[model samples]
Target: MKVLLLGSGGREHALAWKLAQSPRLTTLFALPGNPGIARYARCLEGIPLTDHDAIVTVCGAEDIDLVVVGPEAPLVDGIADRLTAEGIPVFGPKQVAAQLEGSKLFTKELCKAHNIPTAAFGRFAEPAGARAFIEAQGAPIVLKADGLMAGKGVIVAMTLDEALAAVDEVFAMGVPGTEILIEEFLEGEEVSFFCLVDGETVLPFGSAQDHKRAFDGDQGPNTGGMGAYSPAPVFTPEIERRTLAEIVKPTARALADAEAEFRGVLFAGLMITSAGPKLIEYNVRFGDPECQVLLRRLDGDLLALLEATANGRLAGHDVTFRDDAALAIVMATRGYPGDYGKGSVIAGLDEADAVEGVTVFHAGTRLIGDRLTAHGGRVLNITALGTDVREARARAYEAVSLIDWPEGFCRTDIAWRALKL
Candidate 1:
């Protein structure tokens, strides 16, 4: 099968790598892919991701058997709708369905209407209204920008002053125009639960614990993702079962009832509290570093699964993962989640990948002659597989240590929680 994968990030790189391993794959193309992805698939350059017309044209020209979207931004921008409208099958939800991630308020409303378990939230269109709600909710509340801010939208405030400050900051993004979401704080460990939905059938794809904070010990500002480990220990078999039955099932039913009928990966940001699992948020596509770890542990014909989902054949198939744990440590530009220099030459990738059970997935990297240069905040995802998370994490960091990029940084504790177990 000929495949066209979209996006230019570590997630796409991992997807491309896995898809390339399928014997059924005849040719693989990554649209404007990065350096690492280019090794596994032919990278289509110059065409912007938003150019649906160009993508559809290429799909026809390349006789692409399937189009898999790797990021939420394009999916939320209606790229899937456009591709499907052009008679090309796409593995992504439409714009309206993608509101699950595009607009925080939209998901909150969906949860309320469907009786889904989530934090009690209030939506506001003005700063003052948001401030009043923050005061009413008191300290240890949550503040979120109603619109997507690339995973930096939500803020967990531990005090009243911080809560008010978060509102002010979000509102300062714009007043009446700025949308705000203030919700009751649910204290607990967080895990990412992902499922693939082909309208009717919901298949549990994978699970991972993502470190969203920029630094170790969760002490820094939010980032796209600093690192991650797969098959989170906190999300045990029972939790997975309950998550599917209580959260994933109902959301799929609600989407079907609403005639949305999801067609791609649904990432649920979950808070596993004493009260069980509650929704923290949702992402219409796979998580970054989490995707790196999950894909490393995915042990089946990935192409077959993607094709099945895209063609609505999910009911006949079950998503599978290796029992072994996997971990991904993100190597970032020195000042990542903030300002950082770009185009610094990177080295030692070959040595890094030579480490047993390790693979380096590129993000924000470009091949400039014989050198790979950093081109974005999150630069590389060093993923490793092992019998347990501790071993996996050790292997991942070992590979990370091999990388020779002075201008890059990584969180040393990628799976500290699971490691503690």
Candidate 2:
């Protein structure tokens, strides 16, 4: 079977690596894929990823059997809708259904309408209204932009001054002045839970804890994700059961009733609070860095699993994972999620990959002649698998140590919480 993967990042690179491993795959292509992805698939860099018509034409010309979307941007832009309209099987939700991630306000309203447990939130169209809500909600509030902001849209304001400033900053983005979400902050460790749903039956995939804060000890602005580890200790069996019953299932059911019939990976960002697992937000696609570690632990044919979910025949199929733990350390350009230089030559990738159980997934990189240069904020992800979190974390860091990039920086503590066990 031929497949076409979408997006260009560590997540798509991991997906490409896993999909290429499937014996059933005969050919693979990536749309605007990065240098790392080029090793495993034919990358079409000339065409833009968001050009739906061009992508549909490529699928037709290449005789693509399945289209797997890796990022929320294209899916939210309705690329899946165009592909499915042309009779191509897509492993992503339609644009209408993708509002689950496209709009923070939309999901919050959905949770309220369906009685899904989430942080209390209020939508605002004016700065005054938002400020008023923040004043009422008090400090330590969570403020989010209505639409996607490259994962940096949400801000946790710990003080009234910060809350007011956040409101001004979000409004100043030139986004719809009326587009913002002010909610009461929910305290606890956050977990990234992935579920494959076919608008009917749901298939549980796996879970990972994502470190959103950019610096060590969780004190800094949020990037897409700094690092991650799988099988989060906080999301126990009981908590998983409760999350599915109270959050995942209900949301799926609600989407179905609303005629959305979600057909893709439901990335439920949850907060394990004192009450239970509460929904923080949804991504509607795989999480970067998390995908690097999660796919490393997967123990089945990824192609078959995705096809089943796309075809809505998940009843007979089951997804499994290795007992071993996995960890991913993100090696990013210095001063990431802010002003930073690009095109710095990167070195020692082979040495990094030579480390046992480590696979380096590229994010923001480009091949200039023979040299690999940094191209984005988060550059490469060094992921590893081991008997436990400690080993996995050690292997991941050891590989990080091998990379020779003076312009790059990474957190020394990737999975600090899980290393305790």
Candidate 3:
């Protein structure tokens, strides 16, 4: 099958890598794909994802069988709806359904109305109301901007001053009619649960734990994700059962009832609390760094599964993952999740991938002549597979050591929760 994958991040590179391995895949193409993705698919550079008409033209020219969206922005922007209108099959939720990620208040309200377990939240259109709510909520509260901020919009304020300041900061961005969501911070271990929903059928698609903090020991500010490991040890069978029954299934049912039937992946950000698994938030597509590991352990035909989901033929289909564990360590420009310089020459990628069970997925990189240079934060994902999380972590770090980029840095402890190291 001919496929056109969207986005230009490590997640898209992983998807391209997996799709390229499928025997049924005839041609794989990527839009503004990274250097790592270019190895597996034809990279169509220059066309922005926002140009929906251009994407449709590419699909028609290539006779694309499926268009798999790797990022949430396009889906939230109604790219799937536009493609479907042109009779193109897309593996992503439409605009209405994508509100689950586009707006934090939307998910919170859905949880409240459906009785789905989640943190108590209050939405405010103005700053005074948000500040008043924050004062009432006290310290250790969570403040989230209504729209997307590339995963850095939410702030876990540990003090009253911080909480109030966060509100001001969000409003200072000056997005017209911007709303802030103040949520009661729930204490627990967080895990990402994924499922493929083709309007009605919900197929479990494995789980992973993401390191949102940029530094080791879970310190520093939140980022897109520094690193991740698949088959989260904390997400046990019992927890999985409760999550699906109480959260995932109910969410799908509620969306269906609301006439916003969803297709494609539902990435649930869950907090395993004393009561049970509670909804933290949701992403319409796959998670970066997390996807790098999950796809490394998948043991099925990715192209076929996605095509089936796009066509609404996922009723009886299920995916299988290798028993082996997969871990990914994100190597970023030294000042990542903040201001970082670009165009720093990087070397030794070939040697890093030569490490047994290791594959380095590029994120913010560009191949300049014969040199690979950093172009963005969270530049490379050194992913590896092993019998367990510990071995996977070792292999991933080993690959990290081989990379010759002085400007890059990665967290030394990726699966610390699982290994307790």
- Candidate 1 segments whose C-alpha is farther than 4 A from its true place: 174-176
lDDT of 2 by residue, 290-390 (tens): 88888999998999989988888888888889999999999889999899998999999999999999999999999999899999999999999999999
Which of the predicted structures, 1 or 3, would earn the higher lDDT when compared with the native? 3
Model 2 steric clash total: 1
Which 10 residues in a row give candidate 3 its minimum summed lDDT?
170-179
Most accurate candidate by lDDT: 3
lDDT of candidate 2 at residue 343, scale 0 to 100: 96
Candidate 3 lDDT, 133-226, residue by residue in tens: 9998799999888877778888899999998988888776436787788899999999999999998899999999999999999999889999
In candidate 2, position 322 carries an lDDT of 100
Models 1 onward score TM values of: 0.98, 0.98, 0.98
Model 2 misplacement above 4 A: none
Whole-model Cα lDDT per candidate? 0.89, 0.90, 0.92
Per-residue C-alpha lDDT of model 1 across residues 284-366, encoded as one tens digit per residue: 99899888888898888988888888888888787778989999989999988888999999999999999999998988998
CA lDDT, candidate 1, residue 241: 92
Judged by lDDT against the true structure, how good is candidate 2?
0.90
| lDDT over C-alpha atoms for residue 325 of model 2 | 94
